[model samples]
Target: MHDHRRLGRELGLFGTDPLIGAGLPYWLPEGAAVRHALEEYIRDTERRAGYRHVYSPVLGKRELYEISGHWAHYSEDMFPPMDVGGEQVVLRPSLCPHHAVIYRSRSHSYRELPLRMAELGGMYRAELSGVLGGLGRVRAIHLNDAHIFCTLEQAADEARAALDMIRGAYAALGIRPARLRLSLPGPGGKYVADAQKWRRSTALLREVLDNSGVPYEAVEGEAAFYGPKIDVQVADAAGRESTLSTVQIDFHQPERFDLHYIGADGAKHRPVMVHRSVIGSVERAVAHLIEVHGGAFPAWLSPTQLVVLPVSEAQLPDAEAFSRRCARAGLRAEVSGERSLGARVRAARLVPYQAVIGPKEAAAGRVALRLRDGRRLDALPADEVVARVEALVSARRAELWEAEGGES
Candidate 1:
């Protein structure tokens, strides 16, 4: 079994420090490149799916979570409040409350019922030391969280659409869903004491699950304090499953925040809050990606997409020029001229493409492109090579080289 922690260290992706505290792994240069790529891809995906992105503060007034029920029901797992300018403020444990305030910022007409807001925001959890390990469990979380505010009539369809988006994202990331879980509230927890609301919310999620045509387990006592959720679970190499994506129906937050919209009849009506995540957290998502690909990310997601190695010192100028050309085309390319050709090639094995500029090939303004997949195409124009790589990356294709007679 492949352990992400091992691969993460071996690949120089991420690491922790004693001074920085556990569970807060700092991304290395290579890791940051991969993360930036993931962030850009998801932001573009969400924008196309009609989500309006927003930025909210990581800390909120103590009363904010209190009003959202996180302070009352989830304080034990939250960081303690600290005084800021003589007023108590707390690091937010979740982004729902801030998004709630944004939704209530102004009056909205029923025609704009479903206002989809998204943010790749940060939150903190007061996790126990023993439970913290690598990126899977972290005190700080950067969530791909979004909230949809719509009328009751539109909530179900909005939820179904979120599920579809989550599934599509998983496919693009090469992640396989282990199963779907319908998490329900159980007895003696901090669940809000509203049986009727619980039933209504639970029923709505149940219907959404049934119509989704995906088999899911209805597991009790595993829900959020506010409502039921549909968790898309993925298993690691060791066969341990965790929630990576989710769609939830939250009636309590809207009611608590007193969010409303002007209906067609010109009367104010309550709006339902639907919370969803495409990828649960940046840390966990990176962990899973590390394990899934064993550090050999797809071309687009690879940290260093192309590494140019000159066959000898004589070809250094051509190698540098080729690297610059690749960079101009938006490919991440670096030229390695310090070592022998064989050493440079082996050092860049993890990169998606390796370009070799020999004396003959360099003189011809061409390169011998060697794919990480063990395929090599010789004497191709440097511009043609750059264009093909840029195209492959922009399209986010799984394959390194485009489909053709020689490259494939």
Candidate 2:
């Protein structure tokens, strides 16, 4: 049950400035590095999965949300619209409506049955000040979001594909989903009053989950106002569950926006929209990782992967040169000779590996490698050390010491 806020401070990841605002965190360099790594990984994964990445505006005209029904249904969660150049505009609270507009911007045939548009976009929400915590609950969020527009016949397959992607991402992060939830609309019209559409969308999601061989629970009144969804609940290191990923079937927005595609029958047809987030919020995901790993991130994800420690002033040049070698080998490395060797080693615990350049090892063109867990490999050639770390990073190994032959 490590507190992410404390861990963030200890690791120099992120912090909030009251003068700026609450629930808004400023990412330090270390934090930004981790986020960059995550963004690149997700982008690569989405590209390989046939998703087209795009950037959309963070603010939209009032009429845009009106057309998408967000003005009526989710206005309370949105920031007040600002009068900009005589037109009312507000920060976007979600990316799906903008994506719908993107789909409607062009005419598509059945050949483009599944149009997957992905973006690591930012959104703003009006959350209560009392509820704001670290990255878990923030006014600003960066979502690993995407939307899929497809025909009714292709809806289930697309939904299944989204689920598969979610599972693969979780597996890579060493996270286990506690349960899958089918969130359906409840009574009293908290949702849209389209019973027929709701029933169809809910059934389609259930069918996809059942056929995919994934166990799930059905919970009413939890669906988004637009439609039902498959919500993934993941337990943190403390065993507290949080919803991190989702596959939502949106039937309302496409119809509200009059989005359409030409069918095989040569007629206009409404394409079903599936909204998804593989890791939910990038900020929150990093916080989760910090807490789960106790601020010692995996080698591939660590901001500072390697640190070169010079045992004495005479060894400073060797330490600096070794760091350069590591940098040339595509690893994040730096030399630290300002502090005592013991103090430097203690600070290097935040990193995945520390290479000690002492007089004996520097003379032999070698270094002593120290693992975060206090394991040591003495007198390894500098190139060999870089090669070993390069392999771990290339494989995206979750733990440096757990890589095969990594233990000394």
lDDT at 275, model 1: 98
lDDT of 1 at 215: 94
Off by over 4 Å in 1: 404-408
* Deviation (Å) of 178 in candidate 1: 1.3
Q: Mind giving the per-residue lDDT tens digits that candidate 2 earns over 102-176?
A: 888989998997999999999999999997888878999999999999988888999999999998888777666
**Displacement of the residue 355 alpha carbon in candidate 2, Å:** 1.0
Cα deviation in Å at residue 388, candidate 2? Answer: 2.8
Give the top-scoring candidate (TM-score). 1
Please give each candidate's TM-score. Answer: 0.97, 0.94
Residue 151 error for model 1, in Å? 1.3
lDDT of 1 at 62: 97
